[model samples]
Target: MRCKILIATDFSKAAASAADYALQMACLCRMNLAIVHIYSVVLPMVADGTMIFQDSLYDLAEADSLERLSALAAKLNLDADRLCGDGFKPFIEIFSAIGVPAAGIKSFFNRKDMGMIVMGIKPEERYAETLPGSTIRKLIKWASVPVLLVPMDFPPVPLRQIVFTSDFADSEIIALDFLAGIASAYHSDLLIFHNRISMEKGRLFLLKEKKFLDKVAQEIDYPKVFYRHKQKDTLEEALSVMEKNSEADMLAMVHKKHSIIGELFGGDKTLRMISRTQVPMIIFPQSFADIPGPARLGQNQLHD
Candidate 1:
């Protein structure tokens, strides 16, 4: 079976933008894109007691979703009828279920070759403000595949440079190494970005971290991998400054239990770091690098 990039949409503006972004990425990579919308049928009860199956209702809803999906593909100038055995064209798949949204998403991943999950969110101007709540949070935590969070306002630019923020953790290096697809597909330059804490012991820790990053670069030995860093009062502030300096096409981070990801998403500063780049952010699970795939195989070769 052919693999595809799964883009979840709710037909909202944010979702629409995500679909568009996924379409562009899929086209660039010469991969197939599947836009999935999961909906549950709600049938109104009559006074008599019995409820009808209402097949027509579901049919109408499915038709409407397909129509909208077609419109989205049309906007991308993708021909839906053209079938490439590898799923190179854009297609729509509607999953109707009477269960948790996350469960439906998980089911798809279990049965499909899901390269990545791309979701869109509304961009906030301030990071400290109240954050919007949605099923995306649930999906991010539950998904086995990498998740790319694309802000609705972000433009689809060439992914020429990808900046991965590292805390000098081994898991972070593994996560970066796992993303060989994005790098090889775009031929992107990899930036091993780290930020030092100002209040912490200055030169010693700085030298230690620089050496750690250098070791990582040497281990990977990718010609395009480069190291960069900055010292700031806070991790969030340092990330913001680095984003400005790098003009990175994509931002990546490794999410682990009790890591900075937990703190960032748990507090009001979730949007602070996210808003700074306005670029697509890819989140890799700390333990997910071993999964079999071209990317993982490439990482193994690099290690050898």
Candidate 2:
């Protein structure tokens, strides 16, 4: 009945790992967890007396999916009283849908008012990169909420340190408000990381970036803030180094077109950085940051 964290799973090793990670996070935050599995229904070709066979097959598939879902929730201690039959089902909600994965996820979020969405990414092997699949890409593009991508092999760990990549865009302060709420929810420290390219005409860029962050400091009231600025050659290299050196449990970024992420999502460097990330990454779209609700902290208006 509390704020829910929706986790998409396919019962694969990677998805199960993501589910476990979500469970741990939900328990830590004292939030409810919703596990969803999307399955496709295939119809059989018409044949004499085959209608019965088709009906049986359909029933079998649904039953198998439900059984697997119940079994999965049992590990979390949800009994039949809470879910179904004799098992652990009360503590969590499991849904099986026969439709597009992204659409189902979106509908679930709207219905439940989910706090966040967690899904696993099976990083592509081409060029030895960790590129996300089309499903994840679509979900990130269309979902109106924060999407957390857990690498296939990510280990379970306490979310103690969270890093946010800042581009000094006007909407970034709005995004930071959401990120700060998450940091507070988990009792985690926040690190604002900025990687500066040397191509900026002289030192003016650094001065401008500094002044922007100073303005950020004045408007935000979060304690335990760490600011990191690095002069780097490429975005991929800088992000890889941060993951290596920061030991952060999660990374947060805003998805603004014409921003660094826009370039990363379009360029070859996306795979390079995705391959190197050792932690989960949470992306907030521009629309999500613009949502007008409790997150609309009435801070003094932001100015350049």
lDDT of 2 by residue, 147-176 (tens): 887888787676688888887776777767
Q: Which stretches of candidate 2 lie over 4 Å from their true place?
A: 43-55, 78-91, 123-127, 201-203, 257-272, 294-304
TM-score of 2: 0.80
**Candidate 2: 10-residue stretch with minimal lDDT:** 295-304
Off by over 4 Å in 1: 44-55, 70-99, 123-129, 198-211, 218-221, 258-277, 294-304
Clashing pairs in 1: none
* Residue-by-residue lDDT tens digits, candidate 1, 42-149: 777677876676998787777776777667656655433332234445444444443455677667765546767888866543244333344655565666777788
Best by TM-score: 2
